[model samples]
Target: MIFKMAWKNIWRNKVRTLIILISIVLGIWAGTFILAYAFGLIEQRVNDAIGYEVSHLQIHQPDYLLDNDPQFVIKKSTDLLNTIKKDERVKAASQRTLVHAMLATASNNAGAKTMGIEPQGENTVTQIASCIVDGEYLEDSDKNKILIGKKLAEKLKLKIRSKIVLTFQDTDKNIVSAAFRVKGVFSTYNAGLEQSTIYALKKDLDRLLNLKQEAHEIAILLQGADLVTDFTQEQKSKFAALSIRTWSEIVPELALMTNSLDQYLVIFLLIILLALSFGIINVMLMAVLERVREIGMLMAIGMSKLRLFFMVVLETCLVFCLAAPLGLLLAFGVITYLQNTGLDLSSAYGESYGALGFRTIIYPQLQAVYYLRIMLMVAVTAILASIYPAYTALRLEPVEAIRKI
Candidate 1:
């Protein structure tokens, strides 16, 4: 009975009711889309870090973990590689021989973290082939070919087929130098990584280091994201001597930022709702003030003060109910579309975003669970916004309200 009365009262002033409704709808729609964009940027940064800098899991000797000494090799790495590949949960596995080397071009010299990798295995695990912008990816048949980053190539004044010399400490702590020709140039969103990393064939590095079937790191990619913790724990038991760590352990800052983003989401939503609540409160107060005589007539006819309060509150709730779904649905459709065909900001901002550690192309996505939370928050906001107007209705005397023309 109260709901039916409230519904009829709402339509009595169609223009006013619609004005509030549209405000709520637009507020929620804009808020949700902005949140989705924020999440997309954070997710993209984490994905890029995992895809390019580190795999899902890594194994290294205890000494190597302490200092990354070239002498501390994972013995019988070929056997470990076979064992890792046999795990059903592993999507791809690759061993890499890492060295901190001085790369000298005819024009300049720079420090680089050179990763010597198996061409096929590394391509499967890291998907570096997709980033190749110039020349071609490394080949097993090419003994002395190297892959360089675009930024690094620019700094070193290097190009495809350019010869460069690399000097680094080998297994015996002896300095060794090698000359290799650039096979490709690649680009990544990480400016720091782009300027400091290079790649070559694992067999070539192993020969230069005077070691056979030994590597500094074994990186693994899992079939599913949920499998990372369990797989890492399981591998710890098998290779107790070696230090096995997940991507989180390798890059703690990324995990920290990811965890912090949820708190940020809540904070931003609260601010948006708080701003909307003020407008809602003013509209509801006016609605109550405008119908004082009718409310007094109801009170005189033995309608309880509590029931009058509830009726006014229900009116606000109805407005929210009419608007919330429309807003959520509109935001969801737009966000979903953007997720498939990304929002490219590159043309407007150029690649300068990479210098700030962000990708220009963003694919906005929000988990389904967040939509439910947004609905819950909106309901709470509606209830809170109705408070002041409901109180105003309770304060009016029946005789005084009836006298008001």
Candidate 2:
């Protein structure tokens, strides 16, 4: 009967109830959006760091991973690649041989790292096809076709179909010369990769390095992030001679970015929760003060103080039960809209960090567990914040409160 009366009493002051409800709604919105946006930014960083630089996993000669030497090449046959492809967990795999060299012209020259990759295979391993900003990606038919970075092209005065000469030292400690026609020029958001790297058909590197049947590394693309660790471990156990590295391991900086983002989000959420708790406590206290005389009368009329306390607490639960769903609904609407039309942070982050190594587009994602936790915390905090006000109301004296009112 006290619970029923407390709930009915809450609606008597519609304005105050609305104020408290709106506060909760606004708090939920703020917390949800901030957490989602931060996670989105970190996710973009991870994808670009992984896709533009390292594929999900890279299989390298143990010596090459430990000691940076051109001689450390994967001498295995195509059978190994075939075996990996047959694994259901593997989406795509490609071979690459990376070398550092000077690409030059008569009036312009620049030092750049070159990657040799099979065009089709690379497309499978990386989003290579989508990254073609100008002209076209590498074509196997063109024996000497090259894809140069936009920044490198500018520095070396290169254009599509323009001839560029590359000079590099082979594994045998011999200088090799190769001329390639720039088939495409790509602009990446990462300035470092754009200024220092180039790509050519795998056959070109094989011919240049005089290694007809060897590759330096194998890159694998996985379907999703969850399976990367397990797959990397499985591959390492199977291929002991090869060193396997996941994207997170290959680029520890990205891991740091993710961790920092998560930490910031945790702190941000805590602050918002604290603000909400204060709002709930204030509202409950005001309501309790307003009803002190009625509470004291009920306690004097044979109603136990404990029952009066539970009544006030029940009133808070009632308010929360009514407001929480509305807040969650509002949050869901806003998040869904923003997720479809992403908030652009490109203007601040710049086009590329250093070179053609990272992409700029970001997509927002929220896990089911994130929503569950927020909902649970909001409900629990509301219930807990009412306790002090409930205790205060129960302690009031019947004669004093009634006479004062």
Candidate number with greatest TM-score: 1
What lDDT is obtained when candidate 2 is compared to the true structure?
0.80
lDDT of 2 by residue, 114-133 (tens): 89988988888776567668
So what's the TM-score on candidate 1? 0.95
Error of 1 at 40 (Å): 2.3
Please give, for residues 1-405, the per-residue lDDT of candidate 1 as tens digits: 999998988888899888888888888998898889989988998777778878898999989988878989999998999999998999999999999999999889999999999999998889678899999999899988899999999999999999999999998999999999999999887777788899999998898888788999999998987899999999999899999999888989888888898888888888888888898899889989999999889899999999999999999888888888999999999999999998899887646778766889899999999899999999999999988999999998999999998
Q: Which candidate comes out best when scored by lDDT?
A: 1
Pairs that collide in candidate 1 are none
RMSD of 1: 1.7
lDDT of each: 0.90, 0.80
Query: Which parts of model 1 are misplaced by more than 4 Å?
Result: 349-352
Residue 186's lDDT within candidate 1 is 93
Angstrom error at residue 147, model 2: 1.3
